[model samples]
Target chain A: MLAKRIVPCLDIKDGKTVKGINFVNFRDAGDPVELGAQYSREGADELVYLDITASHEGRKTFTELVKKVAANISIPFTVGGGINELKDVDRLLSAGADKVSINSAALRNPKLIEDIAKNFGSQVCVVAIDANYENNDWICYLNGGRIPTEKHLFQWAAEAESLGAGEILFTSMTHDGVKDGYANEALATLAENLHIPIIASGGAGKMEHFRDTFTLGKADAALAASVFHFGEIGIRDLKHYLREEGINVRL
Target chain B: MDVAIVKYNAGNIYSVNYALKRLGIEATITADPELLNKADKVIFPGVGEAETTMNYLKEQKLDVIIKNLKQPVLGICLGMQLMCRYSEEGDVNCLGIFDTDVKRFIPQKHEDKVPHMGWNTITQVKDGLFNAELENQFVYFVHSYYVPVNEFTAATTEYIHPFSASLHKDNFYATQFHPEKSGSVGEIILNNFLKL
Candidate 1:
């Protein structure tokens, strides 16, 4: 059986790990390479490094961080944020990152998805969508949910799958920092509509949230930041809990 | 041992090199025939489409060198697929090192996702690359196409159905999963192969 993954996302700014609540008011976590290595030792299924930095030098620093992460951590990891073109993807992958996740750039140019899949194979492309629940409809957002787009969640996810995205990492801004639970209703719908795997992001407080996401949302994986960063949740303990709850997880 | 990673026109070879580095072995990555032939063991790693990679291998004469190698060779992911007799991916012929054919996974239900991404357990392990410690251990896999369980299957994994997780025939061994990226268990598997 394919185990449900527990991912610890490390949001990078100026080459340091930081976690923000609802995409604002960031707090320093620790060094990315060290944090990532700790997570790996604790039996984290995978790791995600989201580079939130905007400067060109920051981008260069992020690549160096990626190299260090790949060399130190044995588990597979994905690198995202500020990936606008094919060259960016190449740079990260060449640095030994297992996969590359694209968010805003993929939305602005849907063709980017196809080009990545064609050149590097679909397994290498992970399309991350950030959205908010408004007006009884899930509206897509860009720039870390600061700007809204006309695209709806379900339709855009279907389009991304058709456009050759190997996986969809959907983060609901409405429940991001609530620490209540995941947007299971919308997530289950997306899982049903797309053939590729769905990674549920945001709103993960307890082990039950992961269980609910896997059972109700049908998510193949669950990603969280602050909870895992602040020692609020231990990955090994979480996996043991999930396994006891009948959710398949790598122990 | 002089370990050399066969480098053709393929992706994701760097991770394999890094994995070996973690084991304290600085394996050489080269497309040169001389280096490959001279190595004690050769690792043919890839992550790309079948037909295109096969074409590139032929153009660079890597296909012939790989087929004629006498040392132990391990193929991973697409490299494993290319070792088969044929692949449905690009509707092309492969190196025929293993008497099997690769087929794209068809989703049987809503949950049977393609690319079988993430960690999955492998069973029925019996080969030089696998030991008692590896039985039923989870490994990382991310691919759309798979080789069906057959005579050469050294291990099996169940997703939509039981498929070949690893194949062993004589000195050639191949795994559908990326052992290098599979964490600690992956480290053990690579160590086993290196010791062989």
Candidate 2:
């Protein structure tokens, strides 16, 4: 049986982790390698390192950090943020990152998705969509949901799948950071519409929310940041909870 | 001990090299037949299309070198698929190291994903690369095509149906899942392969 995945996304800035994590055993909590190892020890199925750095030097540092993380962590990890072209994907993948996620770059040029799938195989391309619900419609957003786009969420997601996107990372801007839950209704629609795997993001506050996203949202995986970093919920305990609820989780 | 990873045009060999590094082994990633033939262990790891990769392997003569390897050889994902007798991916024949055929996964239900991309548990563990402790252990897998359960199957995983998660025949061993990306359980499997 394929276990529903639990991924903890870490924000990276200038090669270091941006958010303050609450793990006390670490020498430096900001080290992405250490944090990634800790998460792996705590039963995270995968990790996502989103480089939030703006400078070119910082991107180089992020690449080095990716090498360190890959050398230390055994599980799969994806690198995202500021990945605009094939060279960026090649740089990160050559540095040992398993996959790369593209967002605004993909929206800016949908052809980038086809290029990635063609050059690196479809398994390496993860299309991340940031969408906000407005006027009773899910509207796609750019630049981390600050700027709205004309593309509808479902239409763009379907188009991305057709463009050879191996997976879709859907983040609901309206539900993010609210601790309410995932947008299960919208997620179910995407899952039903697309053949590729769907990774549900943006609203995960508790273990039950994880269960809801897997069962109701039909998400193949669920990604969260603060809850796992701040020790609000432990991954082992969450997997156990999900297991008891009859969800197939890697325990 | 010298370890070599056969590198052709496929990707994801870096992850396998890093995984071996975590195990305290600095493996040489090369396509040179001399280095590959001299190494104590050869890892054939890949993540790409089977037809193009097979063509590249034949062009580089890595296919013949891999088939003649007497030392323990491990194949992963596309490497594993290419080791089979045939693949439905590109309507191409493989290296015929394993007496099996790779078939494309068809979605039986609305939820049966094509890639089968996630952590999955393996059952019916056997000797070569699997132990009793490794039974029912979860490992990461990401592939669209799979080799159905066969005589050489060392372990099986259930996705759409029972399929060969790993196969073993003499010195050649293959895994459909990425043992390097499968966390601690994967570490155990890789260690087992190295130990062989």
Candidate 3:
């Protein structure tokens, strides 16, 4: 049986780790490599390092950071943000990323997904969709949820799968940093619509939120940031709680 | 000595290269047959549609080079699938290094997800690739097709049904999961492979 994954996302800026509330008012977390190793020790199934400043800086430091983190940790780590071309993907992979997540890049050039998938294989390529509910419909957001696109969430997800994206990382903007929980309604729709694994991100104040995301949202993985970072919930205890709740977790 | 990772339009080559570096081994990624043959060891790692992968391998003549290699070789995920005799994915024929076929994990009921993604425990370990003390350990897996348990199966895992988690034959070793991502137990496996 495959165990449900518990992921802790690290937001990176200028080679340093930072966390923000609703994508602003950032606070320094720590060195990415150090935090990564700590998370690995704490039993995080995987780690996602998003270079939040990559786009603004017009260059990505994730490659170098991945090299640093991969040296100390054995768990799978995914790097994203400012990944626009095959060379960028190649550089990150060469530097030690197990997977590369593409968001704005995929929206800007849909063909890039197919190209990367063709060159590196789909399983190594992940298309992360930042979604928001507006006007009673799921809309795709770009530029770290600062800009909204006309493309519908389900449509872009299906398109991404067709283009050979191995998995979809869906983050709900509405519930982001709110700690109310993941947007279960939107996640369930994605799970039902896509054949690939869905990673539900954003929200998650408590352990019950994770349970709701997995049970109601039907997500393969639940990704959170602040809760795990601040020690609000330990991964071991959370997994034990989930296991008691009848969720299949690797103990 | 630099390890060579065959880079013929496959998946997860970099992760394997990083894994080698962690084990204190330098690695080079190359599709060049000469560089590959010159390396201390060769690794083939992939994730994708089998037919297209096979086509790419054929185009680069990697199919022949991989089979003729003298050094120890490791394959992961789709790389393992491609090493087999055949794969149901896109109905593609494979390298035939192992006398097994990759088949879809057809769920008898609707609950079975096509892609079996996440961690599962390994049992019946038989190869030196895994530390003897680490039997029945859990490893992460993400794939839609699986190689059925057979004579080459070094380790096995049970999902809806039992399947090969790792397969080993003379000079050839393959894993359905990403050892590079499987944490300490996985590192032990990689270390064992390097020592071999």
| Candidate 2: tens digits of C-alpha lDDT, residues B32-96 | 98999999999999898989988989989888999999999999999999999999988988899
Please report how far candidate 2 places residue B141 from its true position, in Å: 0.4
Fraction of the reference Cα-Cα interface contacts (below 8 Å) that each candidate reproduces = 0.86, 0.88, 0.69
Clashing pairs in 1: none
Which digits, one per residue and each the tens of the lDDT, describe model 1 over residues A10-93?
999999999989999999999999999999999998999999998899999999999999888899999999999999999999
The TM-score ranking, best first, is 1, 2, 3
TM-score preference between candidates 1 and 2, better one = 1
Segments of candidate 3 deviating more than 4 angstroms: A54-60, B1-10, B27-42, B47-72, B89-92, B105-111, B131-133
User: Per-residue lDDT of A1-251 in model 3, one digit per residue for the tens?
Assistant: 77889999999888887888887788877878888888887788989999887554435455667778877788888889888899989888878777899999899899999998778777678899998888999899889988999899999999999998988999988899999999998899888887778999989999999999999999989999988878788988999999999998876
lDDT of 3 by residue, B57-151 (tens): 99989999998888889999989999999999889889999998999988765446667877888988985798667677778888889999999
Sort candidate 2 into its docking category.
high
Q: Assess candidate 3 and give its lDDT.
A: 0.86
Q: What are the clashing pairs of model 3? A: none
**Model 2: residue B6 alpha-carbon error in angstroms:** 0.8
lDDT of 1 at A40: 94
Name the runs in model 2 displaced over 4 angstroms: A19-29
Question: What is candidate 2's lDDT per residue for A1-251, written digit by digit as tens?
Answer: 88989999998876666543221112223667888999999999999999877679989899999999988899999999999999999999999888999999999999999999999988899999999899999999887677899999999999999999999999998888877899999999999999999999987888899999999999999999878877899999999999999999988
